[model samples]
Target chain A: MTASRENSSSFRNHTLTVLAIVLLFLFLWWADGSMAEDLGLSFLPEGLNGYEVQILNLVAVYGILAISLNIIYGFTGMFSLGHAGFMAIGAYVSALCVLTPDQKEMMWIIDEILPSLAALHTPFWFSVILGGLVATVFALLIGIPVLRLGGDYLGIATLGFSEIIRVLIVNATPITNGSLGIKGIPCHTDLFTSFIWLLVVVFCTVRLLSSNFGNVLKAVRDDEIAAQVMGINVFHTKLFSFCLGAFLAGVGGALLGNLLTTIDPKMFTFLLTYNILMIVVAGGLGSISGSIIGSVIITVLLEWLRVVEEPLNLGFVEIPGIPGMRMVVFSVCLLVIILYRREGIMGMREITWDGIAAFLSRFGRKKENRA
Target chain B: MSLELFLQHFFNALTLGSLYGLIAIGYTMVYGILRLINFAHGDILMLGAYFVFYGTTLFCLPWPVAVVVAILGSAGLGVLMDKIAYRPLRDAPRISALISAIAVSFFLESLAVVVFTGLPRPVHQPEWLVSIITIGGARLMPLTLLVPGVTAILVAALLYVVYHTKPGLAMQAISKDIETTRMLGVSVDKIIALAFAIGSALAAASGIMWALRYPQINPYMGVFPGFKAFIAAVFGGIGSIQGAVIGGLMLGFIEIMAVAFFPELSGYRDAFAFILLVVVLLVKPTGLFGEKQKEKI
Candidate 1:
């Protein structure tokens, strides 16, 4: 193909991909709405109730979070266990921002609310962005020091920072309402808001990964010393990715708080980060598409596994619920996957239009041969 | 503060430091050989406590016998963890092993929750162990003094093994270069398993002591102390046993003293360790006893 013709064809492919994604989103939205209402949609998958819709919202939020973590841990090769801390910051800041004055007063029971915070309230969208920005600032401050360390040291430091943040949030009652946590915040995150944010995050992350900056990060992940020798300002690149990841994690947290309509210091524990880490690792490190795929699969899998934890009544007998069985199963799955398929499902490969086209063409050729 | 109060704080710091040091040694040894952060090291500590809990409560064993059983059981579990989770990934990318370590950690924690439940349970100490003693107008439990004494003894034993024994030499050689050690016909796997056994045995000892001191045992009890111990290991310089001990002591002192000085910020005591870590890492990443790692081109 000529250069111009190739460019035009690629542009068309891009448009088609975007349109397809949009259509998928619309279909999902319609289906979700119907499921929530228990309206007739016999041809579709079983409709989700209000509770299920909430779970689906969590999936989208986690999808954004998992992808953002992928940028830091997967792409940049920084093993951070501090994403929860960033999420906590976003959750509290955004939750506080959107809370009405009365709600703030009602929530801050332990101590008198700070006057400045008491007076301030941002729109939901603005609060979410602000939450992300604040988290980015914290990440930048933290990354400057911790990013210099390699491997497990970085993970420890970040994990420690997260614990510190949680502790601080518990103690800083004036601003965060201490450990009592903010309750009854406006529920602004629906399927539309969450899906839109995921789309934006996925788009930007893909673009960034394709850029020179992304290449530098991949190089850093592959071999830090070589990247350093190749004149990459390794620390700056790492810090940038770390901060960006923190920003998205912050946004995800904000959405999560809104979705749950509550926020607490205990909610953003190390386990929260562990879950996100599981998603990133299981999705395939350094793959954005893998993060999304992993996020949805793990999210659904986790929810589905709740069955083993709940009491079951069969005609023959009744099985008692085992409270921790779900986690046992999940952890076993993680161990098996890591041991056997360390690269996870994607193995750093994104599902691209060209690849899909090539795969389909090969299938078509096989069918033609059979005919 | 009065002299008695100061002394009390000093004793508190010592006991806490000793526990940290004991746990840090395990992390130091594992990191020394495998260069993989055994995230499950803390869980092993929890297992030690649980094992004793079961031994004493269910089997009606004496405290000392229960303690020994806990240590030995924990060592066995540690070796098993190495065989099942870590040994296979020895040649894979470092991160894969690290992730596997995390999986093992999560698996152990969840399994603990399954078997033991998540509720915090009290571990009973013998009356003599909890007996209060007064020295220089400062009141202290015998357990307080015993913890540090036990830690010191264990450290000495570890030093003796690392410095004088054949297995110790093998451990050192393996840590220096696993491939070369293998080439030299040393049983690298055995040495690595030995490291886990010793490391986990220490974790068990400390866990039992921790249970006695705190009187509460839970599935997640190991998480925070485990993290703090890792910090201690890093602060002292990873891969250096002596460094881990020194680091543990220093962290204990910092945590105790910070809370002592600022009663208002007592809630932020955990934050102090991390702040210290970031400062040490930024100023000197190798830690106090750690040699700087040089990557060859």
Candidate 2:
């Protein structure tokens, strides 16, 4: 009886913890609303402006993307460079779905099936879900044949897939409007929506990581041969993670498309995938919190570099005209980061409550011990 | 399409194929020796073209001198990259080295962007090489003739080096077993560095010729060709230099003919490569020229 009581108490604690997380997320969402008023703060020395907010939104979206990629790349040990392709699929599909019939007419082949989709013109939220589903379907198609190949071969295959997707989008003028790009997307993404979506992704991902399935996935990453011997179904695990990763990427892309209010084939290039890969590597692969921290750091650093390129003359020593200097600096930093922190900043460790407690105790050992 | 047009594109395809073959050789050689993809190889090619561009336009050097300078400069950069990024991680897992290679590639590309800006610069073709020659009722540029000749020479030289030289024997030994080669007192570092130098030199030569044909240079110019060349290397069997050359030429021919036959699918040119890669992977993971290796548990 006593043991049963104890089990119930621990279960209650778990419930409370979940509640607390939900409350914190709600509070953050509310805070975002108030922060919207200070959009101009981005422009001022210490203020954040609308543009900055938008950039932050982009970072949040990319954070979700990087985390999802980490699931496949870090956990499953699958080297996929085609995350951008999945994202593009989601973005274009979602954009196609959410846009009004008139808007569709302007962009895609609307005359044939306009009557059917016109009635079911779903909301932005539904379109986002639909987009994720579309991306998942595409992932399944690509993953089935390609996932069988291991290591560098898989990487090359995925990279090729990304290029194919890009070129297909460029050529499919009837549907994608070709390289001219799809424009006039309704601006539905903002801090509140992005923050909400970020929370859901984080929560779902955390839940997934804590589940038994996560252990099997990690096992595959650690040693594929051993994992296979243990009857873990390595291929299925990889495919699942790959599909989920692609799905999250799709959702992120949907949000990004909505935020930018425009979609271009060039925007979803291999460089974008490389940027995300850099973030994942810098943050520490296989660490979810690391992806979030890394995304914020990289996005902020990229934005701040604009200041370096400003036409500020430092009296006698004038800065020369360096057009793409930021990318140069960014790449140098990436190289340094890879050299020094090959395991990344967090080294596959997450920021848990125990870590927080240990950090707090360093400053006040006596008081923390008493507590 | 007219017979004349077909003949013209065929020559164009051959020129492009040979250039790809040159670059693909570098990829195949590095992969053969180190089993590393050396993703930065494409950027090295970009650097080579830029070197030539600067040599001719800024320093007023003749085209041949510029080409020589570009090749040497590229070879030096290749050695430096191997020493800095790859050598330390040689003992680590293959994936770690690959990631580092990718990072290095990105760093080089970004650095190029900073140095040369994102704007496209026109590559100046030498006056003598700019003229078109008529053959079999088809117009052919001097570059068309030069590319195949250079490719043939380079392939022969590479074959001879791999088969006849002491260093080639050492490379073959290392590729078979690194520890055994080291036990034999072969300087692994020097041999590896030499491989990189040769690979980079080939890439540089390819880049110069590519620029001559395309007449444009950009920081990101190498990305597509780099990928395609890598595909060519894979298609021909990654560790086989002869295979790489064949793979590259075949890829080039397929791409051009695909575009020529189906203009509607022209935009799907990149897609064609991916599909080919996927099909090859599904049917034969070891690639066309790749030897089957037993997997050890």
Best by DockQ: 1
Please give the lDDT score at residue B199 for candidate 2: 94
For model 1, report DockQ.
Answer: 0.84
* Local distance difference test scores for all models: 0.92, 0.86
Question: Candidate 1: which pairs clash?
Answer: none
Interface RMSD of each: 0.9, 1.3
Regions of model 2 farther than 4 Å from truth: A1-48, A107-120, A358-363, A366-371, B1-3
Candidate 2 local lDDT, A79-121, one digit each (tens)? 9999889889888887877788887675664223345554446
Residues A276-356, candidate 1, lDDT per residue (tens digit)?
A: 999998999988889989999999999999999999999799999999999999999999999999999999899988888
Interface DockQ of each model:
0.84, 0.73
RMSD of each: 2.0, 3.5
How many angstroms is residue B110 displaced in model 2 relative to the true structure, after the best TM-score fit? 1.8
Model 2 residue B268 distance off true place after TM-score fit, in angstroms: 1.3
| Minimal lDDT window, size 10, model 2 chain A | A39-48
Best by TM-score: 1
